[model samples]
Target: MKGVVVGGVSSGVGKTVATLATIRALDEAGYAVQPAKAGPDFIDPSHHEAIAGRPSRTLDLWLEGSEGMARNYARGEGDICVVEGVMGLYDGDGSSTAMVAEALDLPVVLVVDAKAGMESVAATAYGFREYAETIGREVDVAGVIAQRAHGGRHEQGIRDALPDDLDYFGRIPPSSDLEIPDRHLGLEMGAEAALPHEALSAAADHLDTERLVDVAREPPQVDPEPAGARTDATVAVASDAAFCFRYPATIGRLHERSTVQTFSPVAGDPVPECDGVYLPGGYPELHAEALASADTLTELGERAGEGLPVFGECGGLMAMSQSLSTTEGERYAMAGILPADVEMCDRYQALNHVDLEATSETLTARAGESIRGHEFHYSKASVDADARFAFETVRGDGIDGDHDGLLEHESLGTYAHVHAASGAFDRFVDRLR
Candidate 1:
């Protein structure tokens, strides 16, 4: 599908608003808009999916290689894809928006905060466009979207000042309604707090929808392969506000080989009867009290001890631990599946692309095989000395500097969040089979 990257000058520069507006504008122009996010952020993509009416493809070169990222993009069912970029246009090492654009060979429309100046916005856009050439990056900053600018003369001044090479896509007008609230993990889930449709429609009215469609180009051909090898294992997944950081593609992959069941451990649900259980990452810290009283935790601990294969990532890692002690000094009992004490932190412990080389055979991967994923959390897990480890960290922070993937019985707990494209899910289902 044809795609375009909605890049920003930096974080909090209105990239999400501009991208949402662009999606609304394109959809209004009779195109099926598929949204994609440039980094390993599950939050921004929530807003994208809320606006676009579909799951936003998570494209990160570090977690998923160029081909893997392309394949994820190829799975989208739409005429065009609008990728909401990460921090800045040229921020990350390998997972930057520019790198994703280069990988997909897609054009970019820079989102500049036009709240302050007019002509200066045009200059900033020009710098982002030419800075790519100076840094030897294969990026095409085709146009500019003036964000937080007022209508009438303010918008006209910004448009009139733009260089002939850069197209004036449109401006997201200044309004309090356009802003999305945030928490420790970033913006609240779009389902909880999405911008109203009328505000998005207003921003779309000013954009050049024809030009957006004109600038988009098709991505390179990707390998059409499913996430994991097929198996008929029943995989019970933890769901609800507490354990909600799962990808649509990841669930889709599990459905390809397993009967997927979802139960909320935070809502006092019991663990379902299944051969395997997949616990995703989310805000378990916020719902610790409820989770402490859940039957699922005790049931899961027992089942995991009995050799039922279990895979937990991030918040899941915390949930399967001995206990969770919050920063406010409140202590809650967890599943006790892994020999570790998880504690909430004042700041993020790990926030980047992660690489883990399996040290031994684990529930999710075999020995010697590497898994690529991302970890972003504000909690620390202190493992018991007798606890066995399954993976040695190659990149980013794990439980410690060197090791991740704490192992006990048939279950594995790690801070790394891997997608279906990483082949971890395949290994997971294969192990269950």
Candidate 2:
């Protein structure tokens, strides 16, 4: 599919709104739009999926290697793909928007905040483009999207100020209706706080859909990975608001090898009968009270004790722990399968691309195997004195400063969220067999 990167000059520059408007514009212009995200972000992609009506491709170089990221992009289905960048074009330690754009060889439509100044917005866009070469990165900052810009003189000034090389794609006018509500994790899930369709459509009307379509280009071709061999084992995945921070590709990977079933713990559903269970990350703390009264985690604890392979990540880790103490000082009992008490903090405890080496064989990796993932959470886990950890932290702060992957009775919980490209899910499926 032909694609273009919608990058920002900096964070909070209305990139998500611009990208959503761009998607709406493309869809209105009779094109199938595929949305994708640049970093290891789940929230932004949720908004993308809401607008594009498809799962947004995750294109992080750290979680998934260059080849893996390319393959992920190759899997996207659409005539035109709009990738929303993370932070800024050059920002990020492990993976940046520039890296993803360069890897895909896609031209970037820089989103410049033109709310205040038009000439300065053009100058900022030009500086970002020129700064690419200074950093020895081959990023094509092809044009600028004047975000929160006005009509007449304001839009004209931005257009006139652009250099010969930079194109003026269009402008996203200032609108209070375009704003998405924010919380600790970032913007609330798109399903909860998605902008009104009328407002989004109005914003879309301002974008230059023709210019965007013309500038979009396809990334390099990649050999798609063969589907995993199917197994009889059924894997039950937790899929409610509490456990919603899962990558679409992770579920796809699981489905390739097993019968995937989803149940909501927040709504008091019991865990399904399955050989294995997968609990992803999300706002478990927010629903801790409901979870405490739910029977799902209790049943999961019993099943886990019976040698059923269970893996939980981040919020899943919290849900699988002994207890969860919310920031409000309320404590609730969790699954008690892992020997830890999780407490929600005002500030994020760990936020980075993670590298882990399995010190002992676990559901996701064999002994001594390295795994790449991402961790961004606000809870801290206090483990038992004799708690058994399966993995050693190599590049991030795990549960402790040095270790992660709390293991007990064939169940494993970790703060890091692993991608299917890391071979972790494949290993989990193999263990289920």
Candidates in order, TM-scores: namely 0.98, 0.99
Best by lDDT: 2
Q: Give the root-mean-square deviation of each candidate in angstroms.
A: 1.2, 0.8
In order, candidate lDDTs are 0.90, 0.92
Cα displacement (angstroms), candidate 2, residue 409, comes to 0.5
Query: Residue 104 lDDT in model 2?
Result: 93
User: Per-residue alpha-carbon lDDT of model 1 for 47-110, expressed as tens digits?
Assistant: 8888899999989898778888888999998999999999999999859999999989999999
List ranges where model 2 is wrong by over 4 Å.
none
Clashing pairs in 2: none
Clashes of each: 0, 0
